[model samples]
Target: MGGGQQYPTTCFNTVIKTVVLAGLLAQKPFKHIAGFTNSLLKCYAPDLHTFYSETMDHIHRWNPNLRCNFSATVSVFAAATFNFRPQTITFPHLDFANLAWGWCAITALGDFDPNKGGHLILWDLKLIICFPPGSMILIPSALICHSNTSIGSHEKRFSFTQYTPAGIFQFVDNRFKSEKEVNSTEMSAEERAARVEARKIRWAEGLKMYRKCPSALP
Candidate 1:
């Protein structure tokens, strides 16, 4: 007797996107959403609804490296919405403080490999929480951080992060000085290589952000 074949992989792309976009729309400004939608349409091609509803579905089913787990998928869309917010919104003493929030979401076409593409890593801190696929991760944006691991050959990485007003305030690297501001000149080749190596090791060991909402901040 013939037997039925098993499924190759689960399709979670659409579910994740729907959840993230819903969450973003609930909080973000309407003008920001419109601008984001326009950019998204151009990037995905065939327009917003078509890309999200149809093309995304088709690619997730057939494309190899383009697919991602549920959490990664949702986090990316959430980040995208957050990143697309208008610049008119005022913040306290900071220049575009989006990166301050440690909470970020990313999707890789395939497995997490450091040598090939960017991977998630907690900067200047250790992992406090890790939300694998199917698990939700909510954290104080300033307390947590993540980086993208490398993607496989010919694959793409899509990701973004969210930050509340305070998280932005906390993450601002006040000590950071641009070349124009600093007296120092160029760096040695050896120093550049060392920085690259240091970055590699940083991403190799994964870290998590602690859970805390903006309302709880002191």
Candidate 2:
């Protein structure tokens, strides 16, 4: 969580991941996590539940062997990875693995000034949002370029993030096959054209899902 490393990448080392995952399962902190995610989905992204269910259902149908990270009642997927930042400023970047249509939830914790510290910077939206302790936000992480502003040197800051990877859904859809295998599959010209068109439709649908949200920043 520290060392200024980004996760779902090497920055989140194995030791930290193992400890955090074990704690979550043993403690069942998902009560708070689930409550926050569901409330945000209901208020800002009304259609998110439908989208998440549909995606998960599709994955289950294609690959029965695959399992979602979390129970259906808790989260859309097991939290991809949790990021723990301690009074550190992050560089602006987009999450490549997150689904463009899915929302990622982030909650701030620890002691920091609300008015002048630990603000969220949404580069594309041009917003420097106040992020007070215990406050959470749900946004399309894969689509938005975001980072955090600096907190006071003496004050402490920490945050927890939850997200699902689009690649996981794609993997399930491919019947648990690797990406290379899926790409190597043979297809007729007509079939290839149809597949390409289908991808375009799905991409457009994903964009619409983001646009339809009443509050994209929440």
Against the unseen true structure, what C-alpha lDDT does each candidate score? 0.34, 0.69
Candidate 1, superposed: residue stretches over 4 Å from native: 1-118, 125-136, 167-218
Cα RMSDs, all models:
20.8, 5.3
Candidate 1's residue-wise lDDT over 1-218, tens digit each? 00121222222338887687656545534334334433433343322223233323443444346433223323222123233222111122222333232232222222233354443345545532332222223333444444423345554333333322222111121122322332264669896687568647642322322222344356
How well does candidate 2 score on lDDT at residue 122? 95
Candidate 1 Cα deviation (angstroms), residue 215: 19
Query: RMSD (Cα, Å) of candidate 2?
Result: 5.3
Candidate 2 segments exceeding 4 Å error? 1-20, 28-30, 57-69, 210-218
Candidate 2 has a TM-score of 0.78
Give the CA lDDT, 0 to 100, for residue 61 in model 2.
Answer: 63
